[model samples]
Every structure is written in C-alpha cells, then in structure tokens.
Target: MLGDRFVYVAISTILAFSYYILPQKNEHYPTCPTVEIYRPLNYSENKDILDKIINDETFRNSSLYKMQQAIRINTTSFNDDLPLDVGNNLDKFQHFTKFHNFLKDEFKLVYENLQLNMVNHFGLVYIWEGSNTSMKPLLLMAHQDTSPINLKTLNQWIHEPLSGDYDGKYLYGRGSGDCKNLLIGHLEAIEELIKIGFKPRRTVILSYGFDEEISGFRNENPKFIENIYGPNSMYAIVDEGGVSLMNVGETKLAVVGTAEKGYLDLSISIEKQGGHSSIVDKRTAIGIMGQLIVEIDNNEMPTYFIDKNPTFYQYVCLAENSIDIDTKLKNDIFNSQIDQNANENVRNFINKDKYTAYAIKTSQAIDIINGGEKINALPEYVELMINSRVAVEENITIAYNKFVKDTTNIAERYNLGLNVQMAYSDEIIEVIPATEMGKLTIKPITMLEPSPITPIGDKHWEIFAGSIKHLYEELAYPDSKVVVTPGLGTGNTDTKHYWNLSDHIYRYRPGVLPSVNANSHGVNEYIEFDSHLQIIAFTFEYIQSVDALDD
Candidate 1:
C-alpha cells in the first residue's frame, strides 16, 4: 500500500512538471465584441431593403443587369511605356469616359442627387451631401480599371472575355470580379437608399481612380487628393480588398486588410565585353547574371513574426478559434510572443500555406530577364528585373539595402563595378573601380513603401468590423457564426494613395470565400451573382451603421 502511494505521487509530480514546461493551448485570445445596431426609425425599413435584395427577383435582376452593363464597357488600363497624351494612348483612355457616361445613365438617381467632380478628366469623386456637415465624410473607393486580358489566353475564357454573360449562375467578365462589382454595388446601395427615403447624417464620398491598374492617378493628379481631401480630412476610407469570408474549422472569418505590402521593382543591368562565339570568354554578362539570380534565390529573407504585422495577430486569432488546427501549431502560435523557437515554428507553419505566406514575408520574383541577342555571339549587355513585394515588418530602404548586400560578394568576385539607383533621391550610388572587368547597375523602376497600418481596437475598427459581423449574421449567412479579424493584403491597392486622407482606412469587400477566390486575374474570370448581392447589401448596411455613430 505504501509503494502504491509512492507511485501515484511520482506520476502526479511528472504531470505537473510537464504542464509547466510545455506550451499550453489557449482557446481564448483578444477579440472584439460585435457592435451591431439599427436606428429605431430605419430598423424595419433596412430589413425590408435586405429582404427585397434577397427575395425580390426584379430587384435582384436590376442589380445583376447594372453589373453586366458596367462589365460590358471595357475599362481595361494598359501599362504601356508612353504618356497618356502620346499617339494612340489618348484613344485608349477615352474608354474611361464611356464608363463614366454609363454610370450616369444607369444610376440616374445617384447622378441627379450627388455632386460629381471629375479629377484630371478621368478620376471620379462624387459627394453625397449629408444632413450634418460636422461629421467627416465616409470615403468609399473602387478602381474603374481592370487588368488587360492576355490575347493568348483569350480563347480559354468560357464566355468572351468582355461578354458579361450570365449563365443563370455565374456572371462571366473581367472587371466584374475585381472592382466593377464593388463600384456598381456601391451605386446600387445608394440608389436603393434614395428610393427608400433614407437620408444619411454623415456625408458619403465615392472616389474612383481610372488608372489604378497602372498606378497612374496618384502620381499624375496629386492636386485633387491634396487640395480636396487634404491630410486627415475623411472619417474612413473603404476600398476594394480583404478577401471574402474564409472558414477555419467551424468558425468563419471575415478577414479585413489593415495593412498592405510595399512594392519595389529592381532593374539589374550587367555590361560585359562582347566577343565571337568561337572566342567566348569564361564569364559573360549572361553567365554572371545567372549566378547572381541563383545567389539571391538561395539567400532568401528570413520571415519574422512581427507584433505590428496583422498576419501575426491573424494567426493568434486562428490559434484560439480554429479547433481543426494542429495542437502543436496552436500552442506555438500562442507562445510565439515570448519564445523564439515557438515564433520560428509559427512562421514555418505560416510559410507552409503559400497563399497566406506572402502576407508575412517579402516576396521576390525574377519576372523579366533580357540577354543574348544571338546564339553566335557573347551578349555585350544583359538586363534583369526583380519584383519584390516588401513585407510589413520592413521598409523600402531596408529591402533595397538587403539586395545590395546580398549581391556585393558576387560583384566583388567578378571584379564588376557596382551601381545602385537610389529610390527617393536623384543621385546615383556607385562603387566603380578603374580596373573593373564589367559593370553591374541596380535601379528601382518604381518604389513605394508599405502603407501605414490602420488602427485596430478603435471605435472606427469596431464599427467597420461590427458592420461586417452584423451583415453576415442578419443577411449574408444568417446561420453561420463569423469572427472579424484584421488581415494583411499581399498586394498593393489604390488605398495606398488615400493613406493621408484617413487613419481609419479599411480594405474590405464582403462576399463568400469560394466564390471570391474564383480566378481574379486569371482565365475564366467571373463573379457569382449571389456574392455580388452580398457586397451591395453590406455596403448599404455599412453606410447606415457608420451614419449612426456620434463621432
């Protein structure tokens, strides 16, 4: 009996030691309470609007027809190496005016009621005067441009790329998925609000850039953004982003993008002595270029678990909510704050999913490489372009410095002169020796630092997130539970331009997950009619929710 007691105490001691040493799985993390409200006067009226959106066939068809009309007009922006005023390019830009006309014709009420201001002839800014001018206007943004479709894959589309075909299930088109849906949806919401006699207490400003695909509006027409909506002029800016509702185990997540990755394009040029193929040198420009590419690939940047990064917080939310996540992973994610090993483990797990990995890590791609004019001759010159999406944890200067550091050894070994074109400055940074065999030049074709992260856990965030949750609960899903968490956008958006306009900018487009994932820039690009409706309904409810806020 004494021996049995001793064994029981020994086993209990081991269990206690293990419990203290091992990372424990936490089922609760920081989460915001759902702030859902409907003004008593508009409560029943809003419900009827939602019901008509869902059940009324004529209402639904009208919305669908508007989307089709917007998509049918080809507002495809081209990234040609020429000015807008150049030969034939001006004709290409005329398409935007056609789109503008279509908007005026289709949404007659919106055109009639709201005051429109055309920025630089193409950019659209509409002001819907609210009852109270004291309240800062809510800025709703959507680009009026679509990525130009590749002619090679034009045949791969089910319907013509510009058909705007509705097979009674999917509405097939280019701009339909990526933005026109949001643009038209915003109008649909406003048009419906007008019909229902709902006057907002806060002003509504709709801003649409014509050349978001090419990143033109911000650079060309800064006068409008600076003069009209100067620094911190708006209440909040909501652009098209934050991927639709995603599911983790039984918990559905409405991920809202609080931050976006910076963009940098490094144009690397190598110059070497040219020679006949018969008298080829051991090392040519192409050969050295190949080696540099390999070295850059091998020396990938370490993915850090930054506290400021929204993706890190997203995993924390997932660790607490996702029951189907691996036990070890969940524990590591929770302990990552204090433990370095746990942090690395969480990063590795995040890296396993490539879809979400880019949001946390700086992404590099050898997009364009040019060398060798002929097979019989050694190339005299070669050029390579490396596109990098800078991570939120780092800035443009750090990213640029890292590239220079990584390739310094290779440049030294080949006795090549190094030249770096500074991003923000006009002066060229170079280290060229008189006896150098070759020259290596690195220049940034375009450089944009990561956007300022929108503050979370604030009144604006709660209202934005709460509106999402309320929309999902009341109209979107009705049955499924949704957890609204801040997410990081892997790609840059037009919101990058409007950062100074408001600190409370949110990048989100409400829709179902699977349908939202349907080929954004690829072939078979389409948008489900049902998902489109959700966007319209969310916009309508979201506007009203923000209007009710006191400050």
Candidate 2:
C-alpha cells in the first residue's frame, strides 16, 4: 500500500498532465422527457428578486467574502483512535465552535429568526417554523468539516490551504469545494429570504454535521433525525453529493442523485504462531494475508446493468440526449435489458470509463493492513481490511458472500479454521480443525445496504425537478435547455442516516460540468465563483417551490 501523501501526489500528478479533450458533437440525438411543472406562484416577482440578488455587486462580493471567511476556519475532521466520549479527543473540535460563531455573526437574521438546537455538541440544527403544522418540512443538509490537508504538500499549493484567497475567478481554499461552500450557501439563501420578507408556509430545516468527512456523524448516538425530527416527517431532503450539470450539445443534464451505493469494510484477521527469523513455518501470517489480498484483487466485481438501478436510468437519459456517444453504443445501452448480446456490449463499454464502471459494479480497494512487530520475527497475527462501495443493485450479504467464495479454497488448503456469519441466514459457519495450526476470521467493521430509490414522476419529484429546471433556465444557463434526470451517487453522504425521513430524498449540488475539476479532497481545492452563486439561487427557489405544494 502507498503512503497517504504518495497517493495524493500521484493523483495530483495524473490530473496535472491530463489533457482536456472535448467530446465530438452531433446535432440530432434521442433525449429523455423533460420535466414540466408550473413555475412557483409569483414567478415574475421571485425572478426579479433572484436577478437582483445574483447580479448585485455588493451581494456577490459579500457572498464571496462569507465563503472566504468560512474556508479560513479549518474545521478538519479526523478518524482518531480515541472514543467519542473521551474529552481529550473532544478538544480537537474547538474549531467547530469558532465556525459556529462565524455563522451566527454572518447570518444574524437567520440566527435571530429561526429556532436553533445543537446535537452531540457539534451538529447544528435550525428550524424556521411555518404557519401550517400538518405539512411535512423540507430538510436541507451540509457538513461543516473538510478533509485534512497533507502537511508535506503544503508548499505545492498555489495559495495557502486556509488563506481563503480569491484569485478573481476561483475561491482558493481547502473547504471551497467539499464543502463549506455549501454550508455558507445555505445560510446565505436563508438570510436573503429573511431580507426579502419571504416566510414559508411549510417549515424548513437546516442540518450541519461537523464530521461527515471521516464518517463520524453516522455513528453518533442519539441520531439527529430521531431527536430533531421523527421518522417519515420530512417532505424531501437535499444533501451535498450529486453530479455536476453535464453538457449535452445545446442542452444540459441536471443529474439528481436518487440513490447511493452501499458501504462495507471487511477485515480479514489471520492468527497463527510466531517464531524467530531462522525457524519459520511453511507460511507466515503475513505471507498468508498477502496471498489472500492477491486473490481478492484478481477477482473484481462484475459490471452489469440493472433496469431498476438509478444509474441505468441515467444512461437512458444519455442515450436519448447525448450526441457524443457512438450510435451503436447508445442503441446497445438502450436495449441492454432485453438483449443479452447488447447487455454484454454495454457492459464492455462501461468498463472503458472508470466512473461508469464503478457505478455499475462494487468498487474494491485494499486500504489497510497490519502485521508483525519485530523486524526479524515471523508474525503471529495479521489483519487486512478491504473497503467496498457496494453497487445499488446489491446488498451487504451478496457482497460478503462473494468475498467468502473467492477465498474459501485458499483457507481450506491451509488447514485453517474458518469463522464466518452465514449469508442470508441467522446460522453461523464455524469449521474447527481437530488441532488448529491457524484460524481465519472475516467480519464487517461497518456494513450498510444500498439506499432506497426515491420515486420519480410524482408530485414530490415534480417540485424538486421543477425547482432545478427553473434554477438553471432562469439563473445559470438561460440559453441552454436544462433536463432533469435521475442519477446515482457513487459515494455515500450524511443522507444515509435520514433514509426514513422521506422517500423523496435528493442529493444534488448545482455545479457545472467543468467544475468537476475543482480538486475536491485534493491539493489546490477551489470552487468557481459563478457555481457558488448558482447554489444560493437554487436553494432560494427550491424552498418556495416546495412550500407552494398543496396540503
């Protein structure tokens, strides 16, 4: 395995040398149906205010200033060894306290008007009580923490990681992209609504978690959803993970993340007997672990399209709208479900692009390993952890079973006792050797099944899609046709914990296609100024649109 700094440098080098190749354009191609919903009431009035807010020099400058201040705070979350209850570890969260003060100072109106509640010390929840109590509230989520910066790569940065430097076009900072920009954007929108005297009839909730980068918030006791809001109480949720606006000739695709991949971290623990360097067994624990790693790496998850998957529908949109794709490939993708040959062809095509390949299949990465104490000793115990982002079409059991099948023969050959939980059954599999020389145990550190797909073509979807279309058409890309299509997030988000809150969950961030190069979770991270402004506009309009829905 590579060191953390080496991995970052390697990725940065690859991206630096990469050429920006434009896709070939074709004028005529098939396209998915565009959503058609009536514009929010008082459309003209709302548009006038939005136009001013986006164009005003003072507002624009102040928005950028707010984002810059946020980026400077440096609220980086880490996966520390200490437990959450430990006060020494809690001291590391001091920056979150500073960030809270900044939010309160910057968005004074919001803090004064909305009801504020803090969860687990760092999680912030604000509610703007609406007139009607019967209607479910709209939930908005963003994380306050950012990924840690590599200390070794400090000098390679174009601007200091926490400087909050704005170089005319891009706002340079660590959290500019993933994602203090989002946290500030939500606050900016809410503050603007208050300025314009716009109060919602349907309640609106804002949630900000301090440790989403390290997946810490997901494990916190007394979940915010259960305490702040009850099950099935929200109309919809909009979070921080979604694809950028993909360009398709004269039109753009607003890819909304309807479902997310599942998560699994399987640790293979091998235990045997230790010995001095000269007296080694047939195979040491480290040697056995290495062989298992190779076996797992060689057998990757297969790529196949499932019609029910949100990714399959995303391709349906592309097959209909994108002219850059080859005609034969488009046809094969369109006919993949019914025709076996075409399905294979489509699968082959998916493998060409790493992004599409991971979307269809479970991703495997050998991230961590530990063994041996002394330099010359044969290790007695070893542990290898394989991380996987399971595809939406599969579950934890299926992924676990695949790993078991891949290494069962190797484990049996070594005369090792196997201990595993039976797939799809409550029974356990415990094979004890008469005189065990070694033992292998496979257990999940964290396991989560794929999220439920949010239903489309319904009223809930209509309002969500309508707001997206309105935002792009009227504010961001007025000249191009904006098409709203279902999408799948390759990575998980905080919304994983809020699954029961709403069936209309959407994880979307309004970013342009070119903005994907913003260097998120990497060196020189930044967000385009125009893209950040668009986010504020979308949030403002989405609240009104959802509030307009009938009881």
Q: What lDDT is obtained when candidate 2 is compared to the true structure?
A: 0.79
What TM value does model 1 have?
0.93
Worst 10 residues of 2 by lDDT: 18-27
Model 2, 1-551: lDDT tens digits are 46988999998887654422222223342335357644778777877768866677787898988999999997998777656553556677877899899888989999899998877777888889999988989999888888999999999899999998987878889989888878888988898889889889899998888778887543342266566567888988889877767764444678888999999888788888887979887788888888898888898898868766777777777777776767677767666766688789978877787766887899988899999999898898899988899988888888888888655755887777777765445565775542357888777777889999998777877887878787777676676567788888888888888887888899898866323468888889888787788889888888888898865
Candidate 2's error at 53, in angstroms?
3.6
Q: Point to the candidate with the largest lDDT.
A: 1
> Between which residue pairs do clashes occur in model 2?
30-320, 31-320
Candidate 1 C-alpha lDDT tens digits along 1-551: 99999999999999877644554754553443334532333566578888788668898898888888888899998887766433345666888888889998999999988998877667788889999988888999888999899999987888888888998878989987888988899999999889978888999998888888887543333346558657787889998888677877677888889999999989888888887988866778899999999988898877978668887777777766776767777777877776789889988877888787787789889899999998989998899899999998999888877778766767887888888777777777777651447788888878999989888877887778877887777776677677788888888888887788888878898877433487877787887788888888878877887898877
Note each model's CA RMSD in angstroms: 2.9, 11.0
- Cα lDDT, model 1, residue 100: 88
Total backbone collisions for each predicted model: 0, 2
Per-prediction TM-score to the true structure, in the order listed: 0.93, 0.88
Cα deviation of 533, candidate 2, in Å? 0.4
